[model samples]
Every structure is written in structure tokens, then in C-alpha cells.
Target chain A: DQQVKQNSPSLSVQEGRISILNCDYTNSMFDYFLWYKKYPAEGPTFLISISSIKDKNEDGRFTVFLNKSAKHLSLHIVPSQPGDSAVYFCAASRYNAGNNRKLIWGLGTSLAVNP
Target chain B: GAGVSQSPSNKVTEKGKDVELRCDPISGHTALYWYRQSLGQGLEFLIYFQGNSAPDKSGLPSDRFSAERTGGSVSTLTIQRTQQEDSAVYLCASRPPGGGTDEQFFGPGTRLTVL
Candidate 1:
């Protein structure tokens, strides 16, 4: 079962514009969500994250908003730059005991920033 | 290196053969995880290790797959009797000692081709 889903396979945005990516999940067990950016031939790099307790979290140009009731979350990048073009993956995981947190990843959305 | 690293960036093997992939997590990171990403698919959790003990091996697709960590550090994922369907990029991630709330650092990954 695909607990986390990113419906958009690809997205395009021009430089110096706002770029948004959305993710949805069915499992209410998910309480922590993270966004990762990946480039070809490389592993994913952590971008931003949010806890179910908080509605929003921001780091520099990136921000993540979570809606527990709606089972949705979004990653926003303001003034998107060419360097931001990459595949973005949304992952969700819940805390249990013994430090067991296995992240469930989305199919990933390819973002292209036009110059 | 300062970041997580995987060996033999690419591997190709014939069917019915066994292959082993390695992962070296970031120094002082106590949590390790293994994930798989097939072509056009999202990342799939395979297993997780906290220190030298793996509390969750539930994600392993089949009995043919297994993983182990040694000395509270490096990990290895072994797949027995490889099949064509097993071709995918195997990624490893590491989290600090705290918990799932921490963002994970991922390695470049090993692309395994089963022919």
C-alpha cells in the first residue's frame, strides 16, 4: 500500500518564483513528515521537516506546512532558483519504541526551475 | 568522508546470484536504515537498525533478504537468489541518536541490476 502519495509526477517553475509541492497520506499513524531533495546519480538530501504537533516549520527559503485533519502537507520554496531543480520526495514516519522509525517515501516529484 | 557512503556505486549480476551492498553511516549516528527505489517508483523501506540491533526487519520484501549491523556502525544488506524484479537502487540512510524527529542523511546508493 502506498501510504504516502505525490500525485504530480513533474512540476515546472521559473526562477525567482514560488514553487510548491504537495503530499498526502492515509495513515494517521504518521506524525512526522520530511522533505528530501535528490539529484541524478546522488542520494536524497534532507530539506525540511514538520511534526504533527506543529502546523508549520520554516528554514530559510523552504517551509513545510502540515494539516493533520486533512492528511496533507506541502513544501514551499520562495524565490525558487535554478539550483533548486531536482526530485523532491515527501516521507512520513511515526515514532514508536526503541528508536524504530522507518520512513515511507512518496514516488517523488521532479521539479525543474526555468532560468 | 563526512557523509554516508555506499560502495560499488553500480552492480550488475545474473539471476540466482547473491549480492551484498554496504553502507557506512555518518560518524556518531546511531540509527541506520535501508531502502529501495525501483525505476519510476518511490523509496521502499527494507529494514532499520538502532545501534547493532535491528528492532524492525518487517520491511524486508521476502525471506531471501536480510540485513545486519556491526559495532553500532556500518551495515550490510544481503539479497539471496536475485531476480529480475529485484533490480533497483538500494539506498541507506542514517539518523542521529535522538529519534525519528531527526532528519536522515542518505548515501549515494548502489544501483543493482539483476539480469
Candidate 2:
């Protein structure tokens, strides 16, 4: 079963506009959430993360908000750039579970930011 | 050389053949992870290794799949008598000494095609 899900298969946004990507999870035990960006033929690179204790986390133009009650989380990019065009994957994990903290990923969403 | 490195970026083999994929984690990183991604699918966790401790192989699909981390630095994933269903891009990631909270850096991945 897929523990994390990204409903949107693809998204297109204009440059300098805000881009929003959403994710949902089924497991309540997951206390940590992360977003990763990947390019063709390249490994995914870490983008941003949020802890369960906090509802939001921001890094520069990227912000991630989590709603525990709804089991939903989203990543927002302000003034999206063409460089932001890539596939984004949402991952989750629970700490203190030994090596079980390994990440569970979502089917990625391909974001194309048109210039 | 600075980030995680994987060998044989692409591999094409006939059915019933065995293949070995290799990964070299970042220097001094104590945690290593393996994942598989099929076309248009999410990342699937396969195994995890931390220091000299026993690996978490719960995500492995069958007995034909196995992995080992030697000298706590390099890892190898073996798929015996491969099948077409086994074709996918295998990814490896590594985390530093800070444990699960640390962000993981991934390698470019090895794409395997079984025909």
C-alpha cells in the first residue's frame, strides 16, 4: 500500500507565479516529512522538510505547511522559476523506529514552470 | 567523489541473469539506504544500513534480493535470476552522523532493464 500520495500527476505554472504542490499521508505515526526535487537522469535532491511539532517550515522561496488533522501537507514556491521545472516527491518517516525510519515516498508530481 | 556514487548507470540483461549494483556512500556517513523506482511509480524502499548494525531488509520483495554494506562505506545490491518485473532504476542514499534527522544525499542511480 502507498502510505504517501500525491494526487496530481503534473502541474504547469508560469514564471514569477506561485506554484503549489500537495501531498497526503495515511500513517499518523509519521512525524517527519520531506520534499525532494529531481531532474532527468539525476538523483533526487533534498529541498525542504517539516517536523510534526511545527505546522510550517520555510526556506527562501520555498515553504511547506502541514495540517495534522487533515493528514495533508503542501509545498509552495513563490515566484516560480524555469529552473524549478522538475519532478517533486514527498516522503515521510517516523523517528525512534530503529532503522524503520526509512522514508516512504509518493508518486512524484512533475512541475513545469514555463518561462 | 564528494557525494554518493553509483556504478554502471545503465544495465541491460536477459531474463534469468543475475546483476550486481554498487553504491559508495559519502565519506564518514554512517547510514545507507536503497530504493527502487519503476516507470511512473513512486520510490519503493528496499533496505537500510546503519554503521555496523544489522540492516533493515523488511522492504525487500523476495529472497532473491539481498544487500550488503562492506566496511561501512560501500554497499552492493544483488538480484538473482532477474525477471522483467525487476527492471527499474535503483537508487542509493546516505546520511551523515546526525541520524535520521539529517537530510539524505542520493546517487544518480543505476537503471536496470531485464529483457
Candidate 3:
């Protein structure tokens, strides 16, 4: 019953390199996808998001690419910094007329950036 | 300028005791959600509330788990007769009005330890 899945449990990348985090979902009804980064003992911080209408969305150094046909999406952090090291979670949900906007989240990927 | 806040950041209780967790969403946000995260596990959706509409309790695990949003702002989640397996960090998140597709701002989470 796990709809969203993040296959990689941990990832290590060098500073200034590109760090890619991937997520897959089986629920095609989900039209919106989001990524959140979390540090130890802290709430998750918003990262990037993509709507199914488009294939990619970018803000600053982060970009989210979505492939609807494949039911896959990824967050890419270019020139990753040590500050970028954290657990990344992918969540998907559909928006209806009312308050049924429950989110389905992935297991999360722990990314470690080596300086 | 403030973010979502939850009370009793850390709580330790004996098994069979009931525990109530609280969440205060952003001032203008109209959507609120509750999630649970266990060790090495993903965020599990628990419930959702939007404005003055009926709260979505479909994700609630059992009758022992319940939540209420008074005045469409603050929310309280109650777990009755908690079991050892109920130990986990409960997270609360909120989204501003007309921002269903946007990222949710999460609280630091309330960690519950059942002995």
C-alpha cells in the first residue's frame, strides 16, 4: 500500500557536485509533487515542487523534473553545498473541491554532502 | 513571520496512558494536516482539516486516535490507551489559503515515547 517510494535510503555527494534524489509513485491520480528537506530535530523545509502539467520546475539551485508517463520525479541540487546535506522526502497529493488533500510521502532519502 | 508550532516537543508516558498533542497552524493558513514518523520510516498521513469543513479522519489508525480543530485554527490529536507501538514523532503541517499545491510548513514535531 506504499504509494510513494524513494528507493535510495542514503546518498553521498561531494560539495559543488550535482546531487540527485529520485522518487516514484504508483498513484497516477496524484497531480502535484513536492520535495522537503529536513535536518536533525527540525521540521522539514520546503524545497521544490512540480505540477503534472509541466515536466520541470526550477528555483534557485534546485530543480524538480517530473515524468508523468513513468510516474517518476527527481530533485536536482546543482553545485551541492554542505548545507544541502539532509533527508529529502517526496510527497504527492491531489487537490479536490474540499479538504481531502491528504499527502502520500516517500520513505525519504538521507543525503550527505562531503565538503 | 511565525511557523507552525506544536506543544510538548518531547513526551514520555507509560503504556495504556492517553496522550494529547496540540498544533497551532499559521495565522492565515486554511489547511492543516497531521502525520506520524517512526524510526527509519516515512511520514504517515493521519488526518487533515480545511477551514470550517469536516476534517478528514480517514487516515486515522483506529478509534483510539482522534483529532479536533477548534475555530478552524488550533488542532489537537489524541491517542487513547497508547501502546508501545504508538511511539513515534507526530508532525503537524499547514498550507496557506489557495495554496493546496504549495509546500506545507511543518512543525518540529512532538516525539512520543511509550514505555
Candidate 4:
């Protein structure tokens, strides 16, 4: 069974609009959540992260909201630019028996911004 | 290097052939991880290394997959007797040692095509 899931395979938004991507997880042990962006032929880059203790975290035009009770999280990009087009992956991290943290990843949502 | 890098950006191998993918993490990073993404699938964890401890290879799919981190820096993932189902993009990520969140830096990845 998938611990983390991104049900939407793709999302499209016009430049200057708001784009929202959603993710869900089944593991209650997950305490840290992160988002990564990837362009074609390039490695994924860290975008933003939120701890389970907080309900929301924001960086400039990007904001991540977590609803712990619902087991859901969403990433919002305001004034979306064409440059924001890429695959967005949501990952959750939890420490295992060895005291080391490992990430559980979602399938990723492909976002396209139209200029 | 400034970022994690993987060698042989792309590889094509015949079924039953063995292939090795290498990763060079940023200097001083003590944690390394291997993951793969098959078409339309999420990133699957294969293995992880931290400092001088034995690697966490619980996520490896089968005996055919193996990885080693030497000197606690560079890592190599080897797939033995590759099969067509083994085709995927292998990614390497590194995490800096600190108290910050569990964000990881990734390499461009090696796209493997098995025929």
C-alpha cells in the first residue's frame, strides 16, 4: 500500500493565477513534509517543507497548508509563472528504529503554467 | 562539487546485462540515498547510507539490486542480470549533517533503458 499519494496526475494554470496541488498520506507517524520541483532531465530541487507541528508554511509566492486531521496537504503557488511549470512531488519523513529519517514519496503532480 | 551528480546521464543495456550507476555527493554530506522512478510511478527507495554505519537496504526490490558508499561520500548502485522491467530513472540524493529539516539534494539521475 502507498503511504503517500498524489491523486492528480496533472494540473494547468494561467500565468498570474493561483495553482493548487494536493497530496494525501496514510501514515500517522509522518512528522515532516516536503515539496520538490523537477524539470526535464534535471534533478529534483527542494522547494518547501512543513513540520507536523505547524498547520501552514509560506515562502514568497508559495504556501503549503497541512490539515493533520484530514491527512491532507496542499501546495499553493500564487501569481504562477511559466517558470513554475514542472513536476511537484510531496514527500513525508519519519524516523525509523535506527533513529535515521527516510522519506516516503508521492507519485508527483505535473503542473503546467500557461503564459 | 556544488551539488549531487550522477554519471552516464543515460544508459541502455540489453537484458541480462549488469549496469553500474555512480553518484558524487556534495562535499561533507554524510547521508546518501538511492531511489528509482518508473514510468507513472512514485519514487521508490532502494537504499541509504549514513556516516560509517551499514547501509539500510530494506527498500531494495530484490537481490539483483545492490549499492555501496565508499569513504562515506560517493555511492554506486549496481543492478545485476537486469531485466526489461528494471528500466527506470535512478536518482541519488544527499543530506547535509545538521539539525535542519529532512530535505535532500538530488542528482539529475541516470535513465536506464533495458532491452
Measured with C-alpha atoms, the lDDT of residue B14 in candidate 1 is 100
Instruction: Please list the residue runs of candidate 4 whose C-alpha ends up more than 4 Å from where it truly belongs after superposition.
Output: none
In angstroms, the error of model 3 at A26 is 1.3
Place model 3 in a CAPRI quality band. Answer: medium
What is the descending TM-score order? Answer: 4, 2, 3, 1
User: What is the per-residue lDDT of model 1 for residues A1-106, given as tens digits with 9 covering 90 to 100?
Assistant: 7899999999999999999999999999988999999998899999999999999999999999999999999999998999999999999988667657778889
Cα shift from native, residue B17, model 2 (Å): 1.0
For candidate 2, write residues A1-115 as lDDT tens digits. Answer: 8889999999999999999999999999999999999998999999999999899999999999999999999999998999999999999988755654678899999999999
Best candidate per TM-score, number?
A: 4
What's the lDDT for candidate 4?
0.94
Q: What is the TM-score of chain B alone in each candidate?
A: 0.94, 0.96, 0.97, 0.97
Q: Which ten residues in a row have the lowest lDDT in candidate 4 chain A?
A: A93-102
Relative to the true structure, how large is the alpha-carbon lDDT of every model? 0.92, 0.94, 0.92, 0.94
Clashing pairs in 3: none
lDDT of 3 at A79: 87
Shift in Å, residue A114, candidate 3: 1.0
In the order shown, the candidates' DockQ scores are 0.80, 0.77, 0.78, 0.89
Lowest lDDT sum, 10 consecutive residues, model 2 chain A, at A94-103
Comparing candidate 1 with candidate 4, which one achieves the higher TM-score?
Answer: 4
Compared to the true structure, candidate 4 yields what TM-score? 0.97
Error of 1 at A56 (Å): 1.6
